[model samples]
Target: MSDINIELLINTYLVPFGLKILMAIAVWIIGGMLINMIAKLSRKAMSIQKIEPTLAQYGESTVRVALRIALVMVILEVCGIQTTSFAALIAAGGVAIGMAWSGLLSNFAAGIFLVILRPFKVGDAICAAGQTGAVAEIGLFSTTLTTGDNVCVHVGNGKLFSDNIINYTTNPYRRVDLKCQIANGVNPQEAIARLKIHVAKIANLSKAAEPCIEILEFNASGIVIAVRPFCNNNDYWQVFFDTNKAIADTCAEAGWPVPAPHQIEFHKD
Candidate 1:
């Protein structure tokens, strides 16, 4: 082949290829910067609108990912690359990933629903999925809670959404349930009267609703008395513990038998 012909052939192949590669790189960088900027702006706007931080973060991440994917397709086209096979590959990959991570995706979707619905916010005490705690963080896949004892727990958003959520702090007050077992021989009316007196003296107890002392059940060991009083939800634990202790001490001082299971043995062989 002639040198000029060889030179022409090289130029024909290398020049366009080099130019297209440069264009692809430039597009990728610019597209990436634009996507990032847009995502940040979206997050700021959400924040200004008083959206939860967790929701804002999830929104920004999702927007950035979508933008990046679209930018990549544009970059490929700019580089003179046919995207038919590439698009098919991406679709197939996505399908496979979706199938493999269906559980996680479901949780993510549930988290988004939670963000929109606003069932419970951070710092709210809630009971769901048999776990009771204060909400610490809400993420794209899981919700974090800190228990009364300060143990941290992560619950999948799917599970949280599927189960019944009891928001304790949603209402102003909660009824504290207290159970006291007294000897069946003791006068039920007298025990109830004493309980009412003690409950009346409780400083922080809510008097909006009258306190109740009902003879709930007669068990093998004792007569089960149910004491229920209303109190602020924030004082639930305090009221519960205080009432139990006070009931025990008061019954003891009054010479009442605190019912407990007893065993008798007969020996004859």
Candidate 2:
């Protein structure tokens, strides 16, 4: 009779418990695979629709996370755990969870706004959050930027969204502001003509907008000539340096005296 009772207990509880554990493991593995497949399909669909890269990536991540959470709940149910009770527990601790994840939540919200607003996109040259660089990636928590000096930086999305954003690549061309000082004795008209001629030969200069060479102002240091040139954003640095060299070369070639601050001395006898 004792042996029979032992067999019944094992069959009633142990066998079912073992089966439940195995099923839970299977569900977890299968659920994970499905989540990955859904994420991939979502990305492909977004790509086909010609969505922005940042938005597509963000959508994929969000879908993956939500699916993973659902998978966990399914696994808990398979293990004979009450998912409704678990959800209630989470709700009960909502205040504490919110406090602990306040920064992350803010960043996530900011990222959503960034995707919707479309202020800037991947590969755009932007200045935001005191960092100027090409946007490399937009993540839920932070934005990645590749600076001109080749350093990668990550700025929190919350900060980036709250700050002012300057997108340099939005315009057809950007103006390079440069100043060239000429001696007071030099002819401003002649200097302007020479500089313009020199600047015109620079490569990558915008043909639609001619180089604006004009006398800006005069101060302690002779006449300040504003050498403003328009060029595509990609070639801004190259054009900037080339224009500067052109100004120096033009002044030297013209045998113009170097600009110097003038001071008058009154002598008492």
Q: For every model shown, what is its TM-score relative to the native structure? A: 0.71, 0.87
Task: Quantify all predictions' global Cα lDDT against the true fold.
Answer: 0.86, 0.94
- Model 1, 93-151: lDDT tens digits are 99788888999989989998998998998879999988999998887788999999999
Worst 10 residues of 2 by lDDT: 256-265
Candidate 2 per-residue C-alpha lDDT over 1-269 given as tens digits, one digit per residue, 9 for 90 to 100: 69989999999999999999999999999999999999999999999999988889889989988899899999999999999999999999999999999999999999999999989999899999999999999887899999999999999999999999999999899999999999878889999999989999999998879889998999886899999999999999999999999998998899998789988899999
**Residue 61, candidate 1: C-alpha displacement in angstroms:** 5.0
**Residue pairs that clash (backbone atoms under 3 angstroms), model 1:** none
* Residue 35 accuracy (lDDT) in model 1: 93
